[model samples]
Target: MGDLTLHGSVSPDSLKEVDQFDGQEMSAAEKARLEQIVWRKLDRWVLPIATIFYLLSFLDRSNIANARVAGMQTSLKMSNYQYSIALTMTYVPYIAAEFPSNLLLKYVGPRWMLPTMVTIWGLVATMQGVVKTYSGLLACRFFLGLMEGGLFPGLVLYLSFFYPRERLQIRVATFFASASLSGAFSGLLAAAITNIDGKGGRPGWAWIFILEGIFTFLFGFTCFFILPNSPATATFFSTKERHYVLARLKEDGAVSSDDKSDNFSWIEVLRCFKSLHVLMLTPVLFVLGVTLYGLAYFEPTIVAGLGYTGNKAQLMSAPPFVVAFVVSMITAVIADRYNCRGFMIIFFTFCNVVGFAMFYAAKSNHVRYGSLFLTITGCYCSAPPAITWVTNNSAPHVRRATSVAIAFIMTNAGGILATWLMGSLSPAPNYTKATLTNLIMSIASCVLACVNLAYLWRQNRLKAERRQLMTQADEPEGMGDESAWFVYKL
Candidate 1:
């Protein structure tokens, strides 16, 4: 028999697909016990795979900064303005690629799609080393951005498919912490690789690209074996375990079980943009690009400007990221446990405000350097929760995918702005403009956090009141967050 479709839904018989077994006889406590066992198994496989892949993505993308300090500019004969343009070029294609890339990820299985992107971009990152002319470098970066664009949004969506909403932020943070891990690792690697200066007619900066890209490419092959498309397809699970996992997600209001969310829909993609949460969250993320990209692309440069020139500067940039990785994990636990993502974002961003204000006002090098810790803390910690916030509220696959994609699309645009803020023309020692910009972005993020929280709270109230009146057939559109059953996370 054909599956029964629901009104205003792409999915049919939401629970029927997962009700294959006699598990209905089990008590809630037994289900809970099994859920814990299944989740722990998933965590062992999922978190490490996602975190390591993200670390490579971040490393390959941001290692250019470390290479720059290692003499990429003088070796390649590019001017500072030209350097900044090269950075900006990466993001232009990056931003253009995400929306479509996300749609494709929906159409295709992430197991097949995610590793392919990493492998191709890893190759692109390798080719970045061999470019003789500035144009060649620009072309590599552009394609690199094109290949790498889908990864983050893809990974987030991939995790959402396996885990329920509440368990997500910390898992997201686990992978996202790899950004800071990359920062630290990239610095240490760049510092060591610089010792290979003039090897095989290549400068140390070029070697940084070669080695890291090769490693990233190799890692991509492993992802193919590691990731399963979804719980239904995960070979590691027993038949009973698989059905139980799906049932747990279904109970969490993940969506209609037979909804087949992986099947692409243009309507769902377009509909997500109209969401009030997506609408408001887009600009807030855009504003946050100041610190996010600023720290990623220029931490080495920023540290260098503070007086630890060359390799010493790269090494110095490593600590804050190390600190950020630890702090980000702790922050995720608190936010998850308390269910206060909105408050966590505001608190962490406010730290950036203080960090930037301190950086801008500091008289000594040490103090300015110390402030980098605070800036890294806020920039890295707040983002996982922020992105997950949108995904948590969104339903089915397409809406969650689009909502997540749009958040990053705008954030990548902010990446371009972040690139411009610290470009060659900025003041040398103080970088007063970048400082002021980050400070303003931090403060604005805090304000928007409050506003977004308040708005969601209001919507939750309205939904609660209207929920009783809602009929299954007359419920809100499947793609819409306006459904009485859908509560926006504050």
Candidate 2:
């Protein structure tokens, strides 16, 4: 056995049939170099495309907040409740479509499904500019939700097919940071777009929708050409490179037997529901969702309440999200390196608790405005790690897909409460009710995260005990994270 050779002509499928390293043995240094090459290639091919698509998806979904400040509510003659209803309408279809969309992503490759969804949502978002009545606004939002619903969960599932659990946190964080970037960029973009008021016989809010929608629409077409289906089938790589990448993933236990097939299984779906961890984690995501979506949709409004009305408020919203983007990346790197997803989630959620507590009790506008940094960074930081925690634990292709869908559905369900709270508290000058609601939700999120951490620690202890009684050879293949050899990362 010597160093393995990667020629341009070798097929990826042929490598799967071999013993992986049967004919060739490489030195430890060579193996490390090969893995580095694969990772760098994947980083180039997958991460950027997914991050850009999510940025646009979030920008399209949450731009209503930007539009609200720009006069969409008044232009459509909508009350706070009606505007909230319109916001709520987006999540109704969004929630309904998540499970089915994950299932559909299994049938239609991500190359097609993800981009198609983005394109449709972009068109719907654009139509929002033309709606004259509140009913029309509601209709457009519903369709927008229907189109955008699958993207986040779909991307989560898609990434699992490529990276192992330990390496996944940073990639998921990189992808999710796009949402925070969109928050910051939306404020700056909205401030600029609002200056286009009365252009083309349209209000500034209408221009905001039309222009952002066009950018999203164009980006979707670009993704079609760049996004790969899987490492085995990626066209951008040479045949040998593809083969090496897929083989490495299998050696790492990142690629399971179920991942090789596209067949739908009812048994796998049932298995997803039976997992005690998933059951506990679902509600945890729900609570985190309440804090995250609440802040995302209303942070600008909260800023406006500090006496910076109109465009200044929109401009002010950028700083908190900028802080969130920085904190989320740093936390993700530390979580991945230390294998401490659970601890990091609890720490960040506590940051939210403290931030919101200050916001609720503060009298000065400056103090309240400063509190935004803590709240935004904490909420955003906890989210990616929490999501990665679930994906890392769920095994087999179908189970992972179904689990992610369930988690996202619960997350979006919180959006319904968030929008309603914003509307209900709209009449208050200080936004006392909304701030209090966020403070309570942040505290609840921290408690739930702590509970889940305890549960995982117990499970890990039980697994260690069982492992001591059995040999490695006794473990079965393809059991995914549930295999006796597979220790849970707490």
How far residue 100's Cα lies from its native spot in candidate 2, in Å, is 1.0
List per-prediction Cα lDDT, in the order shown.
0.81, 0.81
Candidate 2 residue lDDT tens string, 222-336: 8888888888777777765666776755555556334332346787788788888788777768877777887788888888878999989999999999989998999899999
How badly does each model clash, as a count of residue pairs?
2, 0
After superposition, the stretches of candidate 1 with alpha carbons farther than 4 Å from their true spots are 1-24, 260-266, 470-480
* Residue 51 displacement (Å), model 1: 1.2
Q: What is the lDDT of candidate 1?
A: 0.81
What TM-score does prediction 2 earn?
0.92
My TM-score estimates for the predictions, one after another, are 0.93, 0.92
lDDT of 1 by residue, 1-490 (tens): 0111111232334454444456356666766777788989898877788888889988998999998899888878988788889989999888888878876774567788888998889899999888888899999999999988888888887787777778889999999999998999999999999999999998899999999999889899778888777787778888888878776576556644454443567787777877776787777788666678878888898899888998899899999999999999998988888778899888988989999999999999999999989999888988888998988887656677778889889888988988878877575578888888778877888888888888899989998887687654676445445667666667
Among all windows of 10 consecutive residues in model 2, the one with the lowest summed lDDT is 1-10
- TM-score between candidate 1 and the true structure: 0.93
